[model samples]
Target chain A: MDKTQNNKAWFLVLPVLVIVAFSAVIPLMTVVNYSVNDTFGENEFFWNGLGWFEDMIASDRMHSALGRQVLFSAIILAIEVPLGIFIALHMPKKGFWASFCLVLMALPLLIPFNVVGTIWQIFGRVDIGLLGHGLASIGVDYNYTNDALDAWITIIVMDVWHWTSLVALLCYAGLQSIPQAYYQAARIDQASRWSVFRFIELPKMSGVLLIAVLLRFMDSFMIYTEPFVVTGGGPGNSTTFLSIDLVKMAVGQFDLGPAAAFSIMYFLVILLVSWVFYTVMTTLDNAETK
Target chain B: MMRARSSAIVMTVYLLFLLIPIYWLINMSLKTNTEITSTFTLIPATLTFANYVTILTDPSWYMGYVNSLIYVVLNTLISITVALPAAYAFSRYSFMGDKHLFFWLLTNRMSPPAVFALPFFQLYSSVGLFDTHIAVALAHCLFNVPLAVWILEGFMRGVPKEIDETAYIDGYGFGRFFVRIFMPLIASGIGVAAFFCFMFSWVELLLSRTLTSVYAKSIASTMTRTVSASGMDWGVLAAAGVLTIIPGALVIYFVRNYIAKGFALGRV
Candidate 1:
């Protein structure tokens, strides 16, 4: 696993760098440029400096959207990680059943985000949708379109349904990587089931668990299309998250300066968290190697 | 005995929960538009394929699928092709700023696509690549290339250095060894990476929708426009949704085994 010191590796990486720079760096520069300028209709512009950033920071709407985004991400990570681990543990180790379960479970993940929203939207409709009609028949008031709490629950459940398989699959792979000898040793020691899970399985799954949490968190925080399709940010602004709000600003209203500033801040938060996760992942990798 | 029984129950219930909504969509797709809106029926009382017929017959509807496939395949191909060399370098060699570079690439994956939507629109427009398949394909590489590199690097690191050394001793050049021996060794990795690229590109709407208009509009955007314009044609919408799920289902069927490992190994 020890890598040789070879600067010539740059030649190999050059293609990726060129491609990513074209796609990422150029657009990113444009966002930065827009963040500092004020513009009128005919491409007229003036320097806005920190005005947009200041306004974004002071706005109550921004605060609420950030609050909702954080809560959503936290809830997603908390639920999906443990639930995924549980599902993975229960899954058949090997058989036709394992393959069947995997393929079926992965189906939700492959569906388009908007379609996922559309499916849930139709499935939760009061008139013709199954869930809504069933709930109504049972004398429960459940309308995602009209009620804020209903909207929140629908979005959360929809997300859990869509993404839990990802976590389970990752955990299942982690579990599979554990050598049979480890389980044999645990059995020889007469380890209890809880102890076996605690000592042997939990530690082994930590790496994949971290990856699952990071991915789930980032994706949930940036979620837009599904919720947009489901409620269009809802009867009010209750379901509007950061990305939804930002899209309204940047694309809908053309408030370029504020949106660009908001975007930079949004990008920074993800960058910061990912950097932390990266550091932890590397540390874990090194520990495993050692 | 008790534990095994409980595990089976748990998995059965979980699978049912996952399938019900998809089942609902399919059920809706099978029913006529009038049946879909007027009544609450678990099964289609009168089955119809008119929605599918409409999509297949109409250029606007079916071309959405074609446009999506073109860009998605193009993006996947470009991402994996470029990422292979970068992943090889990261896995095997210690280059300048390698760690920083890797982290930076990953940050793009973490970026909210909403942020890039506007700038990408203007960037592609200025270059006159707007509404073109290549524009969307290239735009997607921002995230897909980084992901492909990360996945491929994990798989590549698992291959021992001895293989490369032996190949060299046998008079195999770098390119030859890579194509013949190294690539075959990591074929599953490549498959997993390509699947991930395709899945992300296929599912993403913001960047693709932003970068392309009429000629290259994806099915996802097309579906959205349908909802907005026609006051919700539930049956046809369900049919389009069902069709969109087909390609992904096919992909998952082919790569089900690798998918778990792909997630566990990539960036972990």
Candidate 2:
């Protein structure tokens, strides 16, 4: 596959490099500049060294935000991975029903994040929202705007509703790719349904599931718009994940130095995890190829 | 046997749970505001197009649709143009620093949109392109182009090299070979890539909302500003949400198979 002898190919990639440099690299450098320096009105700057990073690392606010973010992502991965697999298992193998279910599943993914937030926002209203009203009528006390647990549940449920389909669809695709001979062989051996799933389907699905995990992890880590629209980080800073807190610092409070440092740290964390994902997936790819 | 039955029951309940909100949206869209707010009617007490009529007739609401379309088209076109060549290079060559460059593109995808919100505003403003459709389009291209390149590269690699050689043997030049042979082979791939580009740009808010104010505002942005002294306007908001689905749904219907394939690959 190597074609390094053909230097002319470099011309094709030159434009993309330029565009990315301007958009990503330059702005990143600006962030780095902001991170180390103090800025005042009229474009004045003062060198602050690693002060912002130190402050952020020591701050209780940052610790709580990071904790909330990690917990949120962990809970998301837990609920979605299992739920999606279950849906994929029960989905009709090949029929009108399969297509029907797939298209329906994709419906949630297409809705805009703000709108998804709005739907759950309205749907969780104690007065009008179906969930809130329905629950209250049954004598359960539930209010997202007031209770932290209720807020967390609403956000988690909102995410599950929106994203589980992606995991399901990916798993379904993996299932579809399984060779019929493998299934026939399992059947010939008089394998139980559980054994068939555990031995054959589970291993086969692992490849796509790895991808699902990576995507979900990256997405859940960066999630801001839905939670923002739904809760506005609410009833105090209870639901303010890292991204929400960063925005509040940068825009709301205009603390550019701390926000910039936090963003760099945020980017680094994502980069580290994404690299781990890439390395793992590629290693698996190599194993499969071998 | 009992476990299977219970599993089936669990999955069915899950499906209904997923579908009810969508049904509620459509249900609310059809109902009058009074009906939506007052009655907890499972079905609309009376079907009405008042919400749709209001949104369509109002310049502000209708203009949001137009602005969104303009930026989406611009984003798609720019993404495809830049991405095609980059994808071609990535797929066909092992040029200097190719692996590094490929990974670098992915880093753009991983960076949180919020991180870039302030810097993008400053970057665009310095260039005198603030609050324009082109600004949003260009900002989106930052992520879309990389995604397009990665997805398209995967598809392009699947095409046989023999065709390129055959085209060359027949005296076809690079341009002809790429247009006549390479393009048809990867048409479905490009279609899927284009759809992803459109979908991401369409749904994006943090960047889009930050970049534009008046001329290039999107439907999603309009939904945000809908909250006023008149109250939250749930009926109109639901209608807008339902209407926004039209473009994505239409795209999905046409390329349902490709969309499914694209999703399986995690292209978007």
* Highest-TM-score candidate: 1
**Top lDDT model:** 1
- Model 2 CA deviation exceeding 4 Å by range: A1-5, B1-11, B228-230, B266-268
* lDDT, candidate 1, A1-290, per-residue tens: 99989999999999999999998999999999999999987998899899989999999989999999998888888888889999999998899999999999999999999999999999999998899999999999999999999999999999999999999999999899899999999999999999999999999999999999888988998999999999999779999999999999999999999999999999999999999999999999998888
lDDT for A28 (candidate 2): 90
Estimate candidate 2's alpha-carbon lDDT, on a 0 to 1 scale: 0.86
lDDT of 1 by residue, B112-219 (tens): 999999999999999999999999999999899999999999999889999999999999999999999999999999999999999999999988888877999999
The TM-score each candidate achieves on chain A is: 0.98, 0.97
> Taking the candidates in order, what DockQ does each have?
0.85, 0.58
Residue pairs clashing in model 1 are none
Which is the leading candidate under DockQ?
A: 1
Instruction: Return the lDDT, model 1, position A32.
Output: 93
